[model samples]
Target: MEVKMIGISKSFGTNKVLEGVDFELRSGEIHALMGENGAGKSTLMNILTGLHKRDAGKIYIDGTEHYFKNAKEAEEFGVTFIHQEMNTFSNMTVLENMYLNRELKTKLGLLDNKKMAAEAKKIFNELHISLNLEAQVDTLSVGQQQMLEIAKSLMTNGKVLIMDEPTAALSETEIDNLFTIIRGLKNNGVAIVYISHRMEEIFALCDRITVMRDGISVSTHQISEVNVNQIVRDMVGRDIGDFYPEKTTPIGAIKFEVKNLTSTGLFENVSFSVREGEILGFSGLMGSGRTEIMRGIFGIDRYDSGEIRLNGEQITIRKPSDAIKKGIGFLTENRKDEGLILDFSLEDNIVLPSVDEFSKRGLLEQKTIDEFVALLLKRLVVKAENKDVPASSLSGGNQQKVVLAKWIGIGPQVLILDEPTRGVDVGAKREIYLLMNELAQRGVAILMISSDLPEVMSVSDRIIVVREGQLAGEVLKSEATQEKIMNLATGGN
Candidate 1:
């Protein structure tokens, strides 16, 4: 179950994604693929899995030259790819989604519900996953859906498993369980290709590492042979100094406050405040109603009873537009569906929030918009050919930058960032953090909801822990510790 790809080259029209990249994976070992956004890591994996045809390349599986016709073919041949983006039928039950297109049939060609349920249960049990088979996927939280995807991939019993940011949506406990399962698979001789921007995870879980940059594989080293700094330098081709920049902004009076916020079954009596020029971190286990609270505040969802105040003045935000008009911006965790319109050009997406500002006398001002977009793109260091490129054309990290750019265009007084650096690479993450510092210096209050504990601890001026839809505890950055926060989040103290 060894795979070797050499001299791989792929291009989409004038844009070349991968050029002469080489990667190798051995059986029973986890090989990591690390790269900055748009650095051709996903493109290489897509080429290997047959999602994209390589214009020129050599693929050898167990010393045999071969290429899969499509992803299905690759899966059937014992290569299963669990994409970063969860693939599930929202309307279908969890069990139905698990056995989709590969269901067992009776002698009379009837669907075997009993057999399917048993098989699914067996896999879920082995993986230490607790899920309601009868529940519709849409009703499940993002973390549950992510775990379901991993369980489904395990059911395939593939020889080579490709996991892309598999723990992005998982809680600490779930991530531990997943790591244990992955280790078990490795012991069973299953080769794994682990792709993630989280250096900690890579160093903790992988055996070997390959760094890619600008459409080529720069270096590959054993896990013990390289440090985080070395890997980052290889990926970004420069020393990006500190991982989290120091905060210099002075805190002011309360800029944004949520008082006695209550949603029917989501969150209850949640209250918090962010001072001007302050970055407040929201820490919680996945599905602990953090995102729900933000959505309620942003007017994407209704709260049964709540008070939102800005500058000590109570305000009514019944809709997203209303929130926007009140100088509030929201960067949702689910960026693909809510943050950016995928098919729209980068310029259009960046200017969406400030459309009226670029209009005069009921007429759109094209030059003003173009200038604003170009400036934001440059400021954000968005890696795209031009502002006219579709939002979908950029990589995940670049797409996130574009989302932030749009919020910046509006000059928001308060910004709500949910999982702001979820899938972003190290280099882009620093840039975003620096931008947050800059915004804070300009007196913008930011609420960052994140699952990455290290990130939250490093960037936040203050942190509030949420558990089971309530505010569990709050601590200043100087006084907070990971154990303390986790204890608060899990009701230990």
Candidate 2:
């Protein structure tokens, strides 16, 4: 199979996102598409998958011109896309999600549950994914959910597969499994378009690379012809010195403490403390109670037993509102569900947490709101034409910035971030790291729960490993290693 896209141009209103982009993928070869945040990576993928229309472009599959009116049409042409965003149905089971659009049917035209479950199990085993087919999709971990999305693409029996950051939330072991599956696909003559921010993965897995910057195809080269530094420079149009910014503040006295916290099945006996001007990282395997601990701390979940002390003073928090009132802010793990209201404008979402502050005599003040929004936009570097633009219009990284701005606007004493950089690009990840350090320097204790090992190790002053609803171990900034954390997380003692 061979795929060629020529002179692809797309625009949203006045913004021309993709400008005459051209690329090609050959059979049994992996082609990487690298770009910075808001660089039209998702936009281009959406157009190819028929979610959006390209203003001008020519697509050829196997030497024949092709047109995809919708995702179903793309499927008919053996083109499948695994989106960066989790698009699974939460209410459905793993088998159901895997065979959603194309379900197995019996001779009588009824659904064949047995055949579907068996096929789902077979596909998962082929990918080395250990997930129960009958389990609800929502019960799976974020990494597992991502793997399910990939499985959906494979089920299409497509010659062309487009994977957009497929391993963003996966661990090292899971990533290895994914690579093995990808290699198997390549051996079977499938052409894959791989999009990822991790340079090492691209160099290791891709046969060739195409760089996109400001919506244009800058260059394409074989894996052997380019280096990581050169690729980064081409993607972002700048020399990125350090991916993670240096910590500027020294750790101070403990500002937030949790003692004997237990949330039953979610988490148990979790205890930790974060000092002023210190970044505390919660590390663990999927479903090892990392996010659950943060939820308990932020009062998003009720704990059966626990004690929270802030600045040497014990405080009772019954709910999220109470936690916010006590000067604590939380950025949820699921941004689309809990962080922002997609239909609202960027300004509205930014001021959601602090709207009361801008009210005068029971009336909203537009001037005050605009002033506050302006300051937040400058501080967070939120890229948008106007504050009136809907939150859904922004890219993944920019949407994350809005979530941060919303919580920061309230000026909380303790800030909790769950998977803060899950779907963001490399450039945006650096900015977020800098922001976290700046916040800690301002005497705000920061607690972050992340699945990315490199990110947790780089940005944290102290690390806490949780396993099976309990504290596995605690390591200082200088002592935390990938092996040590993984051992504790997997109960290696």
Candidate 3:
């Protein structure tokens, strides 16, 4: 089967997202769609999946023009979309959620649990994924939930499978497993559309590449014909050079310190300090309590015993408000669920924590609020047409920028960033690194928690390894290597 979209154009009101974009996929090939954030990648895919109406375009399958009314219609035509957002019924069991809308039934008109369970088990076995079928979807971790979403899409057995950042929330091990499954599907003649910001994944799995820029189809080439440099230049119009900036800012006196922070089962006796103008990284495996310690410091999760000291004075922080007022900012790992309120606008989210700053008693200074928002949006380079549009409407990278803007607006003494660049594009990641460098040079203390080893070693002034809910060890950046860090994290001394 082959799917081809020709001269596709779409616009939301006056904001043109995709204009005359062309995308094609053939059976047994993994076509990677590469672009910077807000570069019309999602809009084009939405049109192909029938979730959004294209202003002008022609979709042809097997060289035949066809029109789809909705996603179901597109799916029936062997076109299925696996969104970055996990789509599941949280209240239902995994099996029930897997078989939603297309449930198998018996002649007696009852739900066929036995058959569904077997089929679900078979799919899981094929994918090398394990999870309790009886457990409710809400009980699973984000990584497990993401696996379930991919498995559900596989159950469709569509000819054309569109994956949008399918590995965004997955661990390194899980990513390898997903690659195996994708390869198997490709061998079976399924046309796969893989979208991701990870450069390594693109070079590893994709056969052909299509790069989009500013609502236009920039170019499409065989993966063998292009290198990372060319693709990046097409996407953002310049060479990114080195992704990580040089940390030239000299470290000053300890600006923030957490002494013996303990959060019961989550983490314990986690002691760390961040110097002014320093980028300190916390490294650990996924479940190794790296994020928990930061949460403990920020007062999002209460520590059973600990003292947070800034400069020389101890402070009391019992909630997010307390932390915010005390000049501590946190950008959470789970951006969609925790960091940014999806329903709020970019401008609104940026100024959310400082609402009182613009409101005089019962009155709001609209001009003051607008000025603040405009400045941050320009400073952060949020890359959106209307600041009033819901944050949910922007791409993942742009959404992350908005979240960072929110924290920068707080003017914190110390900032804790958990998985700061998790789902953003490579260009956006570089931009964020430069921003972090700029912040550090300005004397703001930074504590970053990251699972990406290269990022941790390259960008941090110091690295702290966490293992089994404890502070394993700490190393200076000049002395830190991936092997040394991994050994420390896994208790190898």
TM-score of each: 0.98, 0.96, 0.93
What is the C-alpha lDDT profile of model 1 across 1-493, one tens digit per residue? 9999999999888988889999999999999998998998888988899999999989999999999999999999999999877789999999999999899999999999999999999988887887889999988877888899999899888999999888888788889999999999999999999989999889899999999999999999999989999999999899999999999899999999999999989999999999999999999998889999999999999999989999999999889999999999999987877899999999989998889998789999998898889999999889898899899988888999999999999999999999998788899999999999999999999999999999899999999999999999998999989999999999988
Q: What are the lDDT figures for the candidates, one per model?
A: 0.92, 0.87, 0.88
**Per-candidate clash tally:** 0, 0, 0
Q: Candidate 3: how large is its RMSD?
A: 2.1
**Evaluation by lDDT, superior candidate among 1 and 3:** 1
Candidate 3 per-residue lDDT over residues 269-294, each given as its tens digit = 87888899999998887668887788
lDDT of 2 by residue, 63-153 (tens): 9987789988988788888888789999998888888878889999999999888888888888887888888988877778998998888
Q: Give the 10-residue window scoring lowest on summed lDDT in candidate 1.
A: 123-132
- Alpha carbon deviation, residue 101, candidate 1 (Å): 0.7
**Residue 88 shift from truth in candidate 2, angstroms:** 1.6
Off by over 4 Å in 1: none
